[model samples]
Target: MTGGRGRFITFEGGDGAGKTTQSRLLADHFAAQGRTVVHTREPGGTDFGVEVREIVLHSRSHIDPRAEALLYAADRAHHVATVVRPALERGDVVLQDRYFDSSVAYQGAGRVLDAGQIRDLSIWAVDGLLPDLTILLDLDPSAARARLDVARTRYDRLEAEAAEFHERVRAAFLDLAAAEPERFLVVDAALPVEEIARIVRERVDASA
Candidate 1:
């Protein structure tokens, strides 16, 4: 896949697992090397996506599980069409903080819905676009909570879920990575930030 014009890299993990930090590190590294890199995140990558993200993540009222899943799909469809695909076509590396995997884990596993069906919905929404490399920062929900700057009571909708829900989400992420070892680089989220970034960079460099 690296032989292609542009590379697509995705970061996946539970909340407070340092996905944002590592993704930023990667984008900066590539940009420093004179590569054109587009650093973006799901659910809020575009204007419309931001509205959807707010509804899904910060809404005060209740939302049905299926409604939540569809909202995520809607955001992804627009984000990929307007932001991701265009960057890829221009041969720019796209460092994304999350993608379809989040929907599968959060709405499917965490929400106790059909994982396969949720995955299908996301695949169709994104038109089957897959990342060349997915870096899964695996972390225990307990430790992840400790790493968060915000109080637990102040967590977003998804982040405020029960521990058991987060466990299901973590398991789903591991299962997805296990099913696609060639496309996933699983790392311990407890590792030092610089060390984690180094490993990610090595994988990207080798693939490049």
Candidate 2:
């Protein structure tokens, strides 16, 4: 899909899996190599997406699973069109915090929706734009929750979900990595930050 352009790499996992930190480190690595790096996230990669993110992540009221999925797809559509695609075409390494995988794992598995349908909707939303590599930071639910508790005072909608929901999401992410071994680098998120960063760099270097 990239046609020899800059690579798109996404970080996926359950909440508090250290995706944000890992993505930043990877972005910095690429920048040190004199590469243009576009570090962004799913629901807030653009202005339109930021508004959608506020609604989906911070809304105090209930949102149906289907509606939540659609909102994510809408944000993805706009984010890809406005930010991701342009950066890739400019030969910039795109390091994204989340992507369609999160939608499939969270809304599909966590919410008990249809995973296949969620994937299809996302594919249609972004015109089949898939990342060249996806780094899956796998961590136990309890460990991840503890990390969240230490890191923040307020929790988002997804962060506040019960333990079982997070377990389902983690399983879904592992299943996805298993299904697409070439595209996914599954790492233990409990590892030290530098170790995880080293592992990610090795995989990325091999791919490059």
Candidate 3:
């Protein structure tokens, strides 16, 4: 299967996993290889997504867990329509910093949302689309929180959530990898950022 019009690769894991940095390096690599590259993130790719990002991340007002998951799905659906799909149609490599799996870990595991609900929304929002490869940057909770750039986002709110929740999120990510081994690759993100980038490049090369 050619899948979509192009290749979709997502970077996933808990916060401070160096996803943004790794995505950038991989984009540069693909650009060097002459693959039209599209680098994007969730909850803020488009205008509406930016609004939703604020409401979901920084708002003092409480959002129900299911509602939060739905908002994320809504953001991703809009992002896919406006950003990801079009780029793929143009034969671009769509590299996402965080995609649907973030929802599965953060909302489904961290927020205690029902796993079935998350899975359903994922299926609906993604519309049968799945990443050709997902690079999971695995890190310990304390280590990740220790290196966090500082408390700004909601998941960062979980940094103070103690080590256990972050551990659960980590476990959830590993579980996701186990459930979809062919589509998922785990990397030890606790190492240097350069090493993580190298691992991502290797995975992409192997897949390509």
What is candidate 3's local distance difference test score? 0.84
State the displacement of the C-alpha of residue 119, model 3, in Å, after optimal TM-score superposition. Answer: 1.7
lDDT of 3 at 139: 88
Q: Where does candidate 1 clash, by residue pair?
A: none
Residues 68-184, candidate 2, lDDT per residue (tens digit)?
999999999999988988889988899999999999999999999999999999999999999999999999999999998999899999999988999999999999999999889
Q: Give lDDT: candidate 1, residue 20.
A: 93
Of candidates 3 and 2, the better by lDDT: 2
Order of candidates by lDDT, top first? 2, 1, 3
TM-score-based ranking, best first? 2, 1, 3
In model 1, which runs have C-alpha deviations exceeding 4 angstroms? Answer: 2-4, 149-153
Task: Looking at model 3, report the run of 10 residues with the lowest lDDT sum.
Answer: 151-160
RMSD of each: 1.5, 0.9, 2.1
How do the predictions measure up, each by TM-score?
0.96, 0.98, 0.92
Model 3 residue 35 CA deviation in Å: 1.5
Q: Highest TM-score among the candidates is held by which one?
A: 2
